[model samples]
Target: MNFAKGLILCGAIVAASANAQLRFEISGVGSTQIPVAVASFADEAIAPAIVSNVIKADLERSGVFKVIDAGRVISETSAVDYNEWKARGARALVVGSVSKLADGRYDVRYKLLDAVNSGELSSMGQSTAARYTRLAAHKIADDIYEKLTGVRGAFATRIAYVNENRANRLYKLEVADADGEGTQVAVTSNEPIISPSWSPDGTKVAYVSFEQKKPIIYVQDLVTGGRRVVVNQKGNNSAPAWSPDGSKLAVALSRDNHTQIYVVNADGSGLRRVSNSAGIDTEPQFSSDGQYIYFTSDRSGGPQIYRMPATGGNATRVTFNGNYNTSPRVSSDGKTLAWVSLRNGDYGLYAMDLATGQELRLADNATEPSFSPNGKYIMYATEAGRRKTLAVVSVDGRVKQRLTTNAGTIREPNWGPFMK
Candidate 1:
């Protein structure tokens, strides 16, 4: 639980570039989408539609906003044209400008206005490197979203996932923006790589990599691209899940001849067993309060979700609707539990309210569901046609988005923590 140990490990990992950019398509949208219009920036000729387009796309993909045509919106910085926007059916309007600074940076300023009231809601400015124009745009979109929706925006966050290119016989660990843009490979090898759990601070990820000829758990620092083997025990070291405090990881290991949940320090010290079961117990995730660990086990003759103390003790089963359930992930508030459940031979993602015990099925044929930092959406890998792709569904099951890659299969997506 030492911060210094995580820092030391951070300095030892190396960073790498990603291989492909993930393309996203809105497979489904919310029934009631707020109509919003994004006007072209003042200096559009400088970057054309880069910033405005990215902002528009981000909002639209959330399944909560319907982006109006930019051609009909005025790009002026002066008074608001309430009648014009209202005629276009836009409830909210966003206007911004992008200017180049003397230091080679860009000044991106934006304003969120209530079109109906002809009033300014919020305005902010940011300066970023010329190369990070798109990221700067995402940040602005996030700001606008929060100002309008009263929910923290997740647009500025990143995602880590494993890509398997069977044609090239390569397995890659990749990171990209929440919109699936600017993808960069974090690690690549001929063997398989999976899990990919992000650290609490969003700077590091712990995943199971088979590059060493066995299931080995590695903690990779995203900033430095440096990596260290956190668990290289004899049998199998896999399924690494970071604790909420980022000081320890709950992992499933079979070094002792059976797969059981164990807790290990961030620096790979103080390893202790957390789950004791004769059958396989794996995929341990810590609750937001850091008091209980949720996991999947077959000790009761079938795979189901279970919970126990973080320090290891008596276990309690949580799921009762289905005989097969696994990959339990607790929400940010620890009020909801999301996991994969098998129904009629089809695997689907389901969320359960811990307090009410009411269950809601989110998506069918989905696996590896991880909640967004704000607990609004759950991202998981699902099948798209003949290939596997990444998808996201709102916690309410009203909004859905699918991210498809041009080549290879995508799996094991872990949404990162919110950006600082």
Candidate 2:
């Protein structure tokens, strides 16, 4: 990872390796992981949802917890066998149960315990619709993770991606659970759909559609299933990125000059070009505070990352290490930057601490990187053995996992924010 091949302008769907059904192929290990046990929910075998299973899967996928004793029946009220779990090297234990309510809803309950101290750490229960059982399980996992790891879990969030069906020439914009389950199609067309960006509130998504033989930006409401054209100019209106406050979208438009960055109101008003560079500038991502825009440009000889005031003037180079760097993604805290840098001969994912300038390579052959709400992980599309797949890596580059499907190629993954 020391040299560059060439400048790749378009971020297309790179073929990946996986099955028709989406599954997680996790690899690598963290420097440290908490040892815990997630027991089977008492009487959950009689319910339609296996609460404990979902909780265990979410915790394990995070690479923060090593789950054991998942088949043993346990409930929040059950007596804790501290000696047994402590002998098994368990630092913490989780117990939960799901039961039908008289109102036809379901109640999911869970509790976290300290195996060493033999005391309850936390407990929570939620009454939700029958269909939200999986969501509840994810919520429970989030709680357990926060209690044990001191970091909020992203399991309750969602992901938006483009699923390509090349055989039918069809493209679908879909949103699914964090674990790649419960997919719901938001938009579909025979033409190509690229660069899906989620609104900050998680209620809408803006993307580029080539429906009319050209790229047009459109924003769709996930709740209402209604979409409206946000930017349908004479030229290309692609790479729509939302402001941190969800009031505006910074996009790369070819309407004025050579694909300069522009900021427009979320409702398609007040369109104004922001970049004044002679070379092409695109992929405008807003800083966490919505103060500046991070974009790629060829202004200084080779494609490199730069930033400028969100409203307009004074561009400054941000990526000086690479001759070819693109897709600058600032973490939610505005402390780190993630980008795809050409290294050796392949495009790879890299993260840099803006404060310390310490850079770490997250993955090789990765692109379209998006950060999770908690800033703990970065999800990006990458080529895994010639297949189109989506993978996530911890900011420290310690934990890595791939989400792939044999059903079709899924790319342009945008990890959504946590809902209110």
Candidate 3:
């Protein structure tokens, strides 16, 4: 498939703002929910309500903050009445302002305050295009979250998924913000598109597109909408996994008649076999350190996750608790392993501590799990009632949120890397 020409011919670059906004359902709540009050910004001409709404929704959906209703509006530049907020049981308060700039842009300024201590936590200012108001709001939320929690926030990241319109036999590869906003279709085709994987730098995506009546891997530039077929051999070529440094890809190829693991350069040259197993070896993911490659194989009689040296060596079994385990994803810190496991006749998501070997079950009836860039949550695709929806769970399994769209079936979600 000539991916560049195919994307142009199919008209896949769809406007995200034209589609339906994703609706979020909070399934589980955390035990300690911090009460936060976000005051309305000062300016009404720049649509400050839209910015505040996005910030409130982001913190609320994370299950970490309870957005309290600020009874009266407060000016962003005015001093905050800490005693009033403390009486309302709010621990933290967020106040901001939006102003129309002289150069046809918007200036957003925000402050994070500690209500209990009556002190200022942090403050920031940003200037952005009027069209990117929501994105600017998300950046403010990320800053507030990091200041309060001491962990880097992932609110500024993005996610990629496949939206299949079975009725028209059309598939669209879409990208959206982490909160399911700013949806943009990158590519579209009549054939199936699956396994959307983001590049380490968040500029490109590698995915399997069956446009030529067979599985072929393509890497597309997200900025220019230009794409090239990286792996198009005679037989099945699928599951393109990016290495840590973004110089090479680990893919599964059946050109030799049996699916095996192979490492290929980013430009699709110097292909070298990594696994010599007879059983299917696929879904290869490189560790954060790039020292080992983790993959799923049935060489042990049943599908299980195995790890081999990045330079190719003996494979060692990593998952032993179940007969079936696949889609292994390592955390950014390289201390945890998350995968899909079948236990008690039910398939669920599991995470294991690499050092202690202790495992924890995250969710039941979940598939295609992808960890957030900060390793705080795991997003997966599952069936809600009869419709397929996307859900996210905290790593500790304490909080959960489900995201559903009014569009057709949604599947194969891959959380993008952190924004630069």
Candidate 4:
């Protein structure tokens, strides 16, 4: 009856936290990510100092603000002497206190101060269950990110992925809040679901399901629990990638004898070819602008990334580093390309600047990286021992964190677009 059951019969798997008036009033994107100093919260009787570290990690990972390293601090105090923080080149300071609520909850408060002028900029507070203390810290960071960047921080968005239990031969799809809460099954099956991709609008997901014993692509609406077959043609109907506008889907189908990239209507019409390489081509993704289609092809001698016009053009090779590169995804802004690279005898997430052709390594042995809509973060699946879990990291390759529940082997994570 639920979406999760649909996936199991076919094969796959699949909240919002409480409403808080998350008021964000950030100043303009200052000339730079203002340098800020955060003192470690004392009195574990109040809140754990570990929360301070989490907050620091979130701010630093944003690539927006420069946080003063507490490792350099020589004193622990409640009142910040502005000159000390200013001497460390910090323009802002955050001071906070935490207290226990009778309900076994935590009341956390933080105040942002302009170290430059020694004035209060903004203050925010949050309450959370004791187990969610780390999330409380991330919420503080989200408030700061929204205030500064004018975009909501994804610190609270969940990543959905598939997990496999080989012994039982079961596969499960699961979801958890951004801070790793309320993890529940999206779907599960004896078969497998691969390449789960969120539609640009964030209301539905298109994925490859093996419920009928052959790989077929289906689009499932998150709200109505309704699904439509997107592609079920012969010979490997895998890799369903949605276009930026959600008007079309790019997929790899071998119906014509060779696996190649094809574009079709998201509603399952207007099928067309985007790549026609003599060799196998799969994993077709659209550039952020939707002007170009990028895919993996052995047409370049081995699996490598190539780009062509969305309307079809001479394919141009984009990756030159590794002997094999596949599953290329362009960021929302079309500025960076992230893909799995088989280099150094391992598969990891490698990013390349679309304009400069410079590569930045983001993760190790990761697959199916779905970029957040804001283009600031990436969620991908990786193996820890035999189990796969979803790992999220900033675009700059810093601040890596894992989101997992009791369900084992999470794979093929797709971060949905920003949804209210």
The C-alpha lDDT values of all candidates are 0.84, 0.85, 0.85, 0.72
- Sorted by TM-score (best first), the order is 3, 2, 1, 4
Clashes of 1: 11
Q: Model 1, range 1-420, lDDT digits (tens) per residue?
A: 000000112243233434457877776777788899898887844652378889998998888888996573345476777888899999988888888889978888888888899888888888888768888888888887888788888998999998788787777787888998778777777877888999999999898877767878988987877888898887888889999999999999888898899999999999998888899999899999999999999998989899999999999999989888998999998999999998999889999999999999999999999898988899998998878889999988988888877758998899999878
TM-score of each: 0.93, 0.93, 0.95, 0.74
Clash count of each predicted structure? 11, 11, 0, 15
Off by over 4 Å in 1: 1-19, 70-76
Cα misplacement distance, residue 291 of candidate 4 (Å) = 1.0
Best by TM-score: 3
lDDT of 2 by residue, 1-420 (tens): 111101111222222232334678788767888999989988786566788888888888988888887457888988888988999999988998878889988888889999999998899989999878889898999888888878888899999998888788878787888988777777777888888999999999899888878889988888776678999887878899999999999988888657899999999999998899788898899999999999988999888989899989999998888679988899898999999998788898999998898989989889889999889999999876776889999999988999977667888899999877
Given candidate 2, what's the lDDT at residue 340?
Answer: 92
Error of 3 at 148 (Å): 0.6
Off by over 4 Å in 4: 1-115, 118-140, 146-152, 403-406
- C-alpha root-mean-square deviation, each candidate: 4.6, 5.1, 3.1, 7.9
Candidate 4 versus the native: TM-score?
Answer: 0.74
**What is candidate 2's TM-score against the reference?**
0.93
> How would you encode candidate 3's per-residue C-alpha lDDT over 1-420 as one tens digit per residue?
011002323333556654555667887777788899988777734653377778888898888888986755555678877999999999998887888889988988888889999999998898888878888888988987898888788998999998888888878888888998778888888888988999999999999988888889999888877788889887888888899889999998988898888999999899999989878988999999999999999999989999999889899999999898988999888988999998897779999999998999999988888999988899998888787778899988989989988888888889999889
lDDT of 2 at 90: 93
Cα lDDT for residue 365, candidate 3: 84
Q: Look at candidate 1 and tell me the lDDT of residue 319.
A: 96
Candidate 1 overall lDDT versus native: 0.84
By lDDT, the better pick of 1 and 3 is 3
